[model samples]
Target: MFASSLAVVLLTLAALLGAIVAFAWAWRKGHFHVDARAATLPFDDHDQRVARPWETPSQARERVQAHGPPLPPGPGEWGGA
Candidate 1:
């Protein structure tokens, strides 16, 4: 049982490595060149471009309107509209 289980684990690891190599071979043949800027864009200064959190006064108005009218006080009466 020990030897069989070890063989199974080794086979699974070999298959996983083979899959990664196959992927890399295809990518290299296609000349995939991902630039450093593309990788860094998500962490760049997005705060500077947006200027404001929601961008405009209309957006703030929409957010304020989202918090319903008022809620009734009770276990069953929880409707905020």
Candidate 2:
């Protein structure tokens, strides 16, 4: 029982130390620095204007005001069978 408990404690400490080391390494490598454009890499112009069905008229107007007119999705784009 004592041996198992000590093993658990040691394993936990090792895992914590590993996490700290990885975080420090990432910080030093500039991995934590992010550019604004990087956040939009996954989206294109069409994605920015696509209409959302769940939005109310006011919300839709707000979206249009912010992002121009919303484009309707192409046929089958809504995942119907």
Give one digit per residue, the lDDT tens place, for model 1 in 1-81: 567988989998999899899989988887566665677555423322222343377764553455433222343322364
lDDT scores for all predictions? Answer: 0.56, 0.86
Over all chains combined, what TM-score does candidate 1 have? 0.35
Please identify model 2 stretches exceeding 4 Å from their true place.
Answer: 1-6, 21-29, 56-62
Model 1 pairs whose backbones collide: none
RMSD of each: 13.6, 3.9
Task: Give the top-scoring candidate (TM-score).
Answer: 2
- Tens-place lDDT per residue, model 2, 9-72, is 9999999999999999998999997777899898877877888788899988997897898999
TM-score of each model, paired residue for residue: 0.35, 0.55
For model 1, the stretches where C-alpha displacement exceeds 4 angstroms are 1-3, 31-48, 52-81
Task: Point out the worst 10-residue segment of candidate 1 by lDDT.
Answer: 43-52
What is the C-alpha local distance difference test score of candidate 2?
A: 0.86
Scored by lDDT, model 1 comes in at: 0.56
